[model samples]
Target: MFRILAIAALLSLPATAYAEKLANKLLGAKEVASQQAPMPIGSYAKGCGAGLVELPETGPSWQAMRLSRNRNWGHPEMINFLVDLSQTAQRLGWAGLYVGDISQPRGGPMTSGHASHQIGLDADIWQLPPKRVNLSRAEREKLSSIPVRSADQKSVTRNWTRTHHELMKAAALDPRVDRIFVAAAVKIEMCKTAKSSDKKWLQKIRPIQGHDSHFHVRLKCPAGARLCQTQKPSVNELSKGGDGCDDTLMWWVTDYLNPPKPTKKPKEPAKRTRHPREYTMADLPKQCLDVLASP
Candidate 1:
């Protein structure tokens, strides 16, 4: 009787829901193994990390936020790079870096929030530089990142500063940085103020939505770890002297930034459809299962 009830309960669930439940079970583990060597597998959007290292919660020139998520883990190379970058920012007269999510211990699809940051090579750095590094855990969670975009989202606000520009520029120029994603307005601002020689670095800063509060940095594939995958080149390759201020920027500004109202039609009852595909253990590289299973 008990076995029959258990089978009936599972039959009541939708097929997609049942699949997601099984995927959750495989990815639910978030602890790192001390004995393994750090290796990144698959692409940034669908990948996993092994032998991850955690960025210190507090550093002389940086502070990691959202302590409860335990999302500060990353490849050792990335951790070292962030430490060096923060120290450089301090020397450049910026107060300090307020770092955001890096990747989970066994870098896989997060339960919520982001589609990337799954390969241990991506990180979000807040627009508001840390005024102090001794912030309590509670304070870090409650602190808000200052938005750089203006009310209309057509330009940067008053709170935007030269220090912000310098900090972003430094990060873009770093050899390991593949690209830095920011708001269109921020990219426009950089294009306007950039010196002739500095225009090259502008290519590395790509504009995207909802980055007014923080810029995302994605690192290039590391020296090793052959199992990892790379994203296909963008339609307009930035490395080929594409500052991205052409039709692409205009599309984002005119279309995405301020889209037209939807055309109203006769009202129709909503229809049920399958949920969009979600990444599961099978969607990731075969080795990721081993990464998740590791101590």
Candidate 2:
């Protein structure tokens, strides 16, 4: 009887320890990756990663900005992609690439800044073509990425150049990349400037808010990552297979900045949008508990 009771208590330990604590706090406090085989354990916005590898703070063709955050960790695939992309940047007439946040040591809900990037597959690449890749830690933090989109968010600024266009093209063309997010204006500009024959890759360039200074790249679940959830294809992605230029301005801007009001209140209260900051272990994938507990 005593042995049975002990087993029950042991089974209950994880719940008692994790159920109430904020997942972000638990995850954000981790300063190193879990010791396990590399696996992205959940969806882009609702999961964590194990066995994350750190992108070297400074590489021959890339300098990771924001070292203080210690968010340069990612799955092995992402690390490789960034290195390859930075080399591609050199061919586009830039010295290299200035990479921004990738993911925390143990990818999970961040304490601040992003709602996505909970998984290690999503990364932010600054639009600023690196003039030099050997920036000191202090200079990396002090420097700011230039905005390619205008203040009104209606058009691309003078900073938007042919190199920027080609760089995005190269990324979109990458088979590993699922989608790339940029400001609506930048998408519009790319649509206009791209040659008619070159529109095939443009389908991967998605438009989202607050990406004027940096384009966010989200890679597909690495092959054979069974626990990783693939995002559902939107209606446009299924039907059109076209460059996202048409209706981008209207669909993204108007709806984002000034959303349409509900026609009438329903009997039930609307379901609230769940933010990652508020998540606990109970809200995350079950495996994330093991991830947190792993050495």
Candidate 3:
């Protein structure tokens, strides 16, 4: 009986350990990639990518006719992303909170330097009104009798700015999202404000430069997107100075980011791949063997 009980305990240990490891793995998952090629630029069929969580086949899924508001083709998971995003935005006090740029319909040279938007999960959002601050209006008014609504309206609504941080935070938290590319300046601020939890989460987003105009958010392909191509994260690179946003933080390249231009031509690989076999004194020519021995 004692030996049998010991054997049973040993068997249970593996199962318990495996369950724990799986839980940890799920929690630590930072990014996911598609297992197949992305759908071509104008395919209307749904489920374009593979290796992602599969979704329903019915109507009103995500990515309906390029605009997210459409009722058809809006998957529940995608809808969940928008819902969570909008809720988070409201909590953070943002306006015109929505998803944009479903795909890179135009296939030529683009500003983002990649075909990230082609997969149909990325989005862009605008800043919220300052009147929607966390503080009470009476107290805020007492401190400064100024209307922030007007100022917010004057600010660019479609471009990148500090106010978009709410959206960045929302995207970073979503498990479905693969990565986000935001303005260099905005990223700098995020790095400064990033908490320990956010710091771990933000590792999934690959920050790059030249995004001040608008941020690019990319999603990992879901199982429903049958032909969607897998997106890979870019390598970390050094940053050149600009607005003096804290330069100490490390950066990863989101799908929308690009490799920095080299200051000069990089050295080319040697064309001759094969080399002569190494020679040993025993195999040396007679003349060379005598000369070498004389030394």
Candidate 4:
């Protein structure tokens, strides 16, 4: 009876615990090229990259931040897109770009910060343009990105600028960019200020949470990446049409910004006993293990 009870208790433990253990083993590895052909496997949020390349720390029109994180890796297509985008931004009269996290060496669930960016197709571009191209590693760590949203989060703050809008428009118009995520306030401001012709590209600029300091750019699946997975179609595919400045935009300002007070005192929330879901070897493509094991 004692032996049976002990076995049952062990079986009841959350599967995520085991998944995290295996995931840790892979996450600890340094970025390396896989012996296999360069291919992005699975979806952006739940996938991995096989033959990844590192973005140079500094380029003519951009500087990559957070050097210590070793996250400046991506598929070749993504890296090329970023290089072009930075040059375009500089041509548009903005200062050089300040690039942020791209993806881990062997893309998968990261140790912290972000649920997507697992396929080397998503990147974070800092709101503050780079002051200089030759930023030392120490300066990159200390430099802070300015916030564009107001304190109440209902409107654009004083820090917001027309150049910011121009920068986003440039990214949105790029054929390579599938979509860009920004703060809801930033979207609202764009709607009010964008010219009629510029409004067309606004469809690709999506509003999401916590993008006040930077914008996220995701690319469509690259050609020849047969194993790459695409996200399920959203009810309203932004690329097709719809400026997205309708009731959906209002919800962020009204309902999301200020919720009604509770009628009665709420009970204390229960403590979370279960571990949060962490991606494991099972969650990624089978090829990912080989990618991690590669040279």
Q: Among these predicted structures, which one has the highest TM-score?
A: 2
Question: Candidates 1 and 2: which is better by TM-score?
Answer: 2
**What C-alpha lDDT, on a 0 to 100 scale, does residue 219 get in candidate 1?**
87
lDDT string, candidate 3, 67-184, tens digits: 2212112223554576566556656655324233332221111123233332245544323233333334243324322211222222223344454655676677777876776544
Q: lDDT scores for all predictions?
A: 0.79, 0.88, 0.38, 0.79
Judging by lDDT, tell me the better candidate of 2 and 3: 2
Order by lDDT, highest first:
2, 4, 1, 3
Clashes of 3: 28
Show the colliding residue pairs in model 1: none
List the RMSD of every prediction in angstroms.
6.2, 3.9, 22.4, 7.0
| Residue 114 in model 3: lDDT | 32
**Top model number, lDDT:** 2
The model with the greater TM-score, 2 or 4, is 2
Q: Residue 259 CA error for candidate 2 (Å)?
A: 8.4
Q: Which 10-residue span in candidate 2 carries the lowest summed lDDT?
A: 2-11
Candidate 2 per-residue lDDT, tens place, 34-131, comes to 88789998888889999999999999999999999999999999999999999999987899999999999989999998988887999999988898
**lDDT per residue (tens digit) for residues 70-163 in model 1:** 7898888889889988998898887678899998888878766787887789999999877788999999889989999887778999878888
